[model samples]
Target: MSDGNAKKTSSKESFLPQIFYNALLVGIMAGISWYAQKHSVTAGEFVGAFASIPLPVVLFAMVMDYLFDTGSLYRKVAGKKGLTGAITALGVAGFFFITMTWLVAGTITMNFSTITPVIYVVAGLLTLLLLWPKTGTTHFVLLYYIAVQLITKFAHFTLLGGVSLG
Candidate 1:
């Protein structure tokens, strides 16, 4: 095969793995949530609740988060010549919070004070560890797990009328 064809084929092959990985992550999250809900609610109720959620909204929120994160990281790594890194990071953080709040609507209440310290500590540790060499994938997976937890909590609040705030 020509060099151009080989490059195209390699990129296409790489894309499939990423899609499969994301699908697997979603499936695992769904399975765990289903099992937890099944113990408290009937199967029909669980199905109804799951079916009521707007998939597009959830996907859009996730995609926005992913994009903001990528942009912030890119700025930090490639645009470090000035205050661009800090500005981009702050903007991305604000955007993420705004997007998450919009996605949840008024269905969930969050007590930021109660969780702020824990979030800071965990985030700090993760950031430090992720800065170390060869830890990017592991840290990303951990972050994804945190994202899944938040998603599950939002789903519960929206679908099952669960109290999310302490």
Candidate 2:
């Protein structure tokens, strides 16, 4: 390629869009919080500064997963056809996610002991949404995952007040 074309391409592919996305995430959260507090809406609860990850971090992780993942674990269970086999696969996937979440969270929540089973199933299904070959590795799935985080936090703050499930 010509130097002129390369320079044009680089200029067109500037970091502004990524910066906009990051700004949008922060702005949405802050706006929701501000509106809720100003209106005397119930602040759900403070999960923690560490409860959820930011959009940029999750986006970076998705890129890394796309580049480096072997898909061995996903492949192992994703091929099951029988109902019982599928259920087992779901359970295993759920267990793996919950354990990872716990490890990352570091501090245990007050409600952990009481709701382990429910959370396990939900988390499993969610993980599978991205693990399924038809959907998991797609560019849109990563965007959807981060979008979910954004919407969820917005809902929690706007409706429940500060956090979720308060």
Best candidate (score: lDDT):
2
Per-candidate local distance difference test = 0.41, 0.43
- Candidate 1 lowest-lDDT run of ten: 116-125
- Residue pairs that clash (backbone atoms under 3 angstroms), model 2: 43-161, 43-162, 44-160, 44-161, 44-162, 130-136
Instruction: Please give, for residues 47-132, the per-residue lDDT of candidate 2 as tens digits.
Output: 22212434443454355345323566544443343444456554764564554334323334666755333233323333444343
Q: Point out where model 2 deviates above 4 Å.
A: 1-51, 55-72, 81-84, 103-106, 109-125, 145-166
TM-score of each: 0.30, 0.36
RMSD of each: 13.3, 15.7
Look at candidate 2 and tell me the lDDT of residue 144.
55
Q: Candidate 2: global Cα-lDDT?
A: 0.43
Candidate 1, residue 63: how far the Cα is off, in Å: 1.7
25 Cα displacement, candidate 2 (Å): 29
lDDT of 1 by residue, 123-153 (tens): 3222323222234433353344345446566
